[model samples]
Target: MAIGKLFIGRKVRDIRQANGATQAQFADMVGISTSYLNQIENNQRPVSASVLLSLAEKFGIDITELSSGQNDRLLSALTEALSDPLFETYSPSLQELKLVTQNAPGFAHALIAAHQAYRRGNEQLASLDDRLGAAPSQEVTPYDEVRDFFHFVDNYIHDLDLAAEQLATELKLGEGENYAALSGHLEAKHGVRVVRGEAGDEAIRRFDPVGRILTVSRYASAPTRDFQIAIQIAQLAAATKIDQVLKQANFRSEEAVEICRMGLYNYFAGALILPYRSFLTAARDLRHDIELLAARFEASLEQVCHRLSTLQRPGLKGVPIFFARIDRAGNITKRHSAARLQFARFGAACPLWNAHQAFETPGRIIRQTAETPDGVRYLCIATQVSKGSAGFRAANPRYALALGCEISYAGAFVYADDLDLSNRGAFDPIGISCRICERIKCTSRAVPPLKRKLVVDHRVRNPMPYEID
Candidate 1:
């Protein structure tokens, strides 16, 4: 892996100030000269290896805390936000962006948040006339809020994951018997009864605390029944730990807190069913073959793919993966990334992505080696998944699941074995969203890039109506 230069001046300064350390004192503590420390704090000099180690050891912080991943994420977000048409006249240079991101990160993040609010408002009022003149509401939906909270954390909760693993081990919840073990645990530990309801019921599961009855739908698949049991286990047996994590989250609204609570409960359930060590071992041994691993763990395909993205357990980190589920309309209903690729937070995914093609060929894993505008290449594997409505007359929900990793790590995946990854020409060009994508001459582009000009030359005909400037 290539290590990027660390420009964490603001973070270092904040830490020093928070500890009430003066410049000279902090320099002495880190065994650096005051002048060098000042330069480092101002982003004039990158943090040296010695200084980074000293900061981690002397301050008792994780070494990864000083990594440049957060800086890259913030920079990427700020750049994407600036590409909005609302900031057309304010085109800052790359160096200017770097400076703001490295020095004034808080302001940069705030500006990006404001622009996102404006964009959301514009989208909400897109059908109304004079929408451009109206001010955007400064609010974010609870679902989006909770989703971003998980997304930004790389979809990993180390402490909660460890707790789930411990619980699973203590309960001796072996493979193929998760549902029974979990049901027994609920009854023995929390005076709860697990029962299956009629197949006609639409709800997947319902809980009645007063009656101490947990009713699961008979229509659910075996894996789903087991998953629901684990979820209830988290809600009851892991309530104290869940409460602790919720307190740490400090969500703004009660609704967001509840949503985050549910997310955490689901996360715990995944960790419990697919305990970290065993799952990681199986994944590696199977070369990350989703179907094989799913069979081994008795988990759903989506569950397996989703769990792969959350294997960022510090020293025991697995391959960084990006997982997303898109409906037939190209709407991303579920998304998480431990890779460099971040999905579009608004609107549909790029039409060129192989994930969309999964809808065309159901049940088969579609493969594509795609290159984004940023030049990052990925080995993408996608397949369509559907749920039976349990009745002929009802509608069944279907989605395409996309799971991928950076090209550099493609060797670890079973899906990439047949691909010509080294042949750059074989990669398809894709983008995040058409509005901010800089892919010129793309036939599937729904709209022009927000920050680019167009040349309409009627005399010289081309595939596209207008040539992008």
Candidate 2:
């Protein structure tokens, strides 16, 4: 049997095409023969160490990434090209095509690039609208929807704290006993089997809706287990609210609506586990110490950080924050925050941020102050968390989560009180909006923003143009 080579040859080919480099050019740059590079791209030959190392060095990427597959690879380019809202209206097969693109990455790039082009074209048209004096389009951008969600969360404080306290009191989940007790309670009430499976058992938890039972993995940490319970509780308790919010959104597709609903359910789950008011008080009292909050709320450090970002429940807001979780290769896995951060939507994140450094110092909260090109400064707190399977046979790996907020709100918490903000020694300069930023001088930019149109000029004074193409 042939070995399933780990390198994504399709993706590598797409990247080369995107860069406008001929195969010969790339091969020459990597110090390899063109025929050998062709074989690698065609999947007939595995990427050599020398070639992989050269590519990683040039791209400032990890060699491990060049050899492995992503957990959640996006859809392929051709699928994205074929995926029109019009197709979903007429043919259900288009949906299957989309799923194929999502799972099979050769199609992912086509979809992503196509969508990027589609968005850019619309943006250009919108720019022309101002001159024509036409009314703006009523269509809602995904960015606007996300922004509105955060805006609503920033002010809308719910009664989740009271609910959590009451549930804890009623269930006697506090001053915690063994996880087995919770497991037994679940079994008795919901028919769930809290069996300890090997980590990386493929399915960490399986909810049999028909059986009205869930099989949870024993490899989960106490906090992870509690989070699972909280999710179940949220699904049961807040189904109505979740449905209502999703229905009101008028999502373009059923899949989008379902995705949003699941996201909201998870939000509610986090709120249930770490009730807002009490969590806020602890965060303030402990000076934003993550370990203290983790112990107090019986949550993982990453969970607390994620919950802190959502403190934007309108009216009684905590701090406006920005959150991003990235691996060593700068691939962002989970990101949700209220702050105006500039990040590449479909590619790698910026390299200068201190979030990556958190992996070097696991569990300990690291803080840094960053200044955007707009002169806005933010206080970024980041840390690494453990990642692995919950079952004995599981092949779980580790991951990291990095979160931060504006420096103005840092005083509301105590994590960095003794650190001298006046000194500016600990703080590094960074930008939030990477696309719209005109700071062409930045050496760390992985890819140019989608907004900037490239122009080929034979007689241009400068090599790069800031103006739209």
Candidate 3:
């Protein structure tokens, strides 16, 4: 296989500027000529392997970090965006797209932003007449800005993760008394009290900042209570660390900043409850068994699954897993992937995926070896999880959690032991979505692919698609 050139002009410039070094000085440090460094910074030339080695040896940069993260994800998203039906006239080559993603990422981002605005604009235009209002240009939502921040970082906040891991050691959460430690710390250090709310209250956590009280719902589960306490402690004790990250994020809207802030705090809580070093050790020792890990950590099934996807701590990485939570309607509410498989960002997931079928068995974990259109096989598993309600009248949301990694790592997962991983027939075919899927024949396909040609045959007298080009 031919290796694609790695053009990280922006990243290279960022490194040099961060170290407060002149172009000539930085060029000398990286064992490159000043003119060659200028070309690399301008994206006129690709960074060579020698320069990559020098980057590691001279400045202690992680070459692997540069190879992945934003570049790979951005390229994937950009390709998906271009596959929209609206771009019927323009068909840019994969090489061209790669160049755009690598050399001029800002332009690539702007193009994607325009496409997102176009998508939102169409939705607004459809509802304008019925609502008796004119269609207005929609700016990108703060939620999307925050989601992008998390996505580009591959769902790992290193500084916050290390800090939370340290705090967990200090609080002795590994002793299995997580709730007591978090609550005591909240009260003793931050003048905050954790109290149970009234019986009929529907709110999960209601805080009075002035009164320094964190009131959690009475009907909430033990895991939820402990989680809420951790969230409070995260905000109070880790404010400085959170701010340092927020400053680097540089979100345009205050809403995005706060949303990202809460995301970081939530991350801190998860890290504290399940400290990285100990949790990773436990996960490996148990062969990545979700239920066993949940039992050992005293956490919920969903929490354990989500934590498994975030073990990307540089050199000591865990399995490259993808995690998602979906509702009965197939709406994916929470998702992250360290694996190569990218979840559909638009509509629902592929109907053929086992996640949708999980609602039938409820508590049972359904496992399968599934192959995507890209020919990447993954060992996937899904199970249903429901939150308890305050009462019969209150809403008790139920969601299905799906977790998986590449088929090669199946040996490390207990769930894959019973599967016939060697047989090609055992792998079920799946796609991101019907509209983007290139599968030629599928009964579950809701619509023909936007970019493919179709031929209908009425003489067959069947409700099946004749031929998908």
Predicted structure with the largest lDDT when compared to the true one: 3
* Residue-wise C-alpha lDDT for candidate 1, range 167-231, written one tens digit per residue: 88887765547777888888998899999987678888899999999999888887899899889
Q: Candidate 3 has which clashing residue pairs, if any?
A: none
> Highest TM-score: which candidate?
1
RMSD of each: 3.2, 23.4, 3.3
* Cα lDDT of model 3 by residue, 64-111, tens digit: 666665676778778788999889899899767877887788898888
Q: For candidate 2, write residues 1-469 as lDDT tens digits.
A: 1123334455567667877899999878778888987877766666666666677777555554343213122322233234344234443354454345434644554445456657655666769845575544544455544433433343132544445545555555535652554565567766765555555455556677777766666666778776776677667666776777666666665656666666666676677667676677777788777778888877887788788776654335566566667877767776665654534454465567778788889767777777766566777777777675445655555566777766766786565577676766566766543443446666665556543455556666554443234
**Relative to the true structure, how large is the alpha-carbon lDDT of every model?**
0.85, 0.60, 0.87
Off by over 4 Å in 2: 1-117, 120-169, 172-175, 178-193, 197-201, 209-212, 340-346, 362-364, 389-394, 424-426, 448-469
Candidate achieving higher TM-score, 1 or 2: 1
Name the lDDT of candidate 3: 0.87
